[model samples]
Target: MTRDDLIAMLREQTPACGPARNALIAGADFVVWDGLVPANRHAGVFRTRMRRSLKRGRTVDGLANSVDILRRAGEEPLRTGSIDAVDRSFWFMIFLNSTATAVVACFGGRRPITMESAGL
Candidate 1:
């Protein structure tokens, strides 16, 4: 789909607060960054740094659980047709954002919320 199509779909389907929306926003940011900088110069480094950042001050199990949520939530948009085919960098950012958002939403609260409970 075109950029405008993607944006409209995102606005329509993404919740006010949740993993899907977080991933969409992150994907958008990645698109912008990819346009400005060569992916070879930044993508790997960014991914590694983000992983380490998420691991800091968090348990491995918590991190793993967050990752699982991210994987599920990130694919939902694509599977539902909110997004069309995208490049590897776009997918990476979606996963990164979803994972990061999940970690925050899950661990930041007294109790972890499921993807359904998160309102998608």
Candidate 2:
């Protein structure tokens, strides 16, 4: 899908609460990451690494809500899209599988109070 389409879709999603809400921010770039080295899984892999790294905020509230948005658009299998992080605080991603399922990941910040999640 086009960048505008992706942004629009993400905009309608359940945004993060508090100041860092509105996951879709101005000047952010939306891209299809299905072509890089690890293919569509690039963001996911990094998420896994982050989960294993300094912080793993999967169980925390407000973090894992983005995946619900991704799952809603899971009809397109094996597709992936990512939103460039704004303010170096957070980035969002959506990955679709062959089973017509999708997962969204949104994370930001560095060390200490980092936010990470892959909502189902």
Candidate 3:
């Protein structure tokens, strides 16, 4: 989908996934992309390998819950978005499954050294 369309879709989502949806979609200093590209280096989503997964147990932690949620999607397409926000920048990921579910998650943090001098 087009970048604007993708962002618009994300803006219309509810709290099905992350608790920080509103802030994530608010006044983004930089536009988020489906994947990291040269144009915007600070925020993007991409398919990633979960290094460590917390298996099922009697009790579940936040990480476990997130894992289990994604697990239910099985081998279905899943993309994780990692944001390294500098100041008012923003980032988030939209996960879609076969059951027509959408899980949105986001985070913000200091921009990396690579983006220090790079223009938005």
Candidate 4:
């Protein structure tokens, strides 16, 4: 969808949804899922990091769980990555899945949220 399309959806949908995890739907965008990490400069970083970590025998958190929660709460996964941007909390984007046709959510909170969006 176009930027206008995203903004229109945000305007109409966000207010109705209200706050989630202390988040207000700041905005929305039509974007590709990138998985780059340590500086997410690529779209495939989501899958890549997940795969790499798993290969190293790391126990990944239930990322799918987080996605499910976000979707149920009316959000879509955009760029998945661990960012220090949330005051010790990790952040990820949910760009309003097509079903909702609504606003995107940047889901984050103390403790590791989930790795589903973080994984490839």
What range of 10 consecutive residues in model 2 has the weakest lDDT sum? 11-20
Better of 3 and 4 by TM-score: 3
lDDT of each: 0.31, 0.42, 0.34, 0.37
Q: 1-120, model 3: which lDDT tens digit per residue?
A: 333343444432333223234444443333333432221111121112122212222221133334444444444544444322234343333443222233333332232334554764
Ranking by TM-score: 2, 3, 4, 1
Candidate 1 local distance difference test against the native: 0.31
After superposition, the stretches of candidate 2 with alpha carbons farther than 4 Å from their true spots are: 11-25, 35-76, 96-120
Model 4, CA-based lDDT: 0.37
lDDT of 1 by residue, 33-118 (tens): 11222222333443454488566653222334434444444323211112112222212122222212211212111223458747
lDDT by residue for model 4 over 14-117, one digit each (tens)? 32222222232333222534442222222233346556756876633433333334445432233332222233343334334444354443332333546764
Error of 4 at 28 (Å): 16
Best-fitting candidate, measured by lDDT? Answer: 2
Better of 3 and 4 by lDDT: 4
Ten contiguous residues minimizing lDDT sum, candidate 3: 39-48
Task: Write down the TM-score of every candidate.
Answer: 0.24, 0.41, 0.35, 0.28
Best-matching candidate per TM-score: 2
The runs of at least 3 residues in candidate 4 whose Cα sits more than 4 Å from the true structure, single-residue gaps closed, are 1-20, 23-45, 56-86, 97-120
TM-score of 1: 0.24
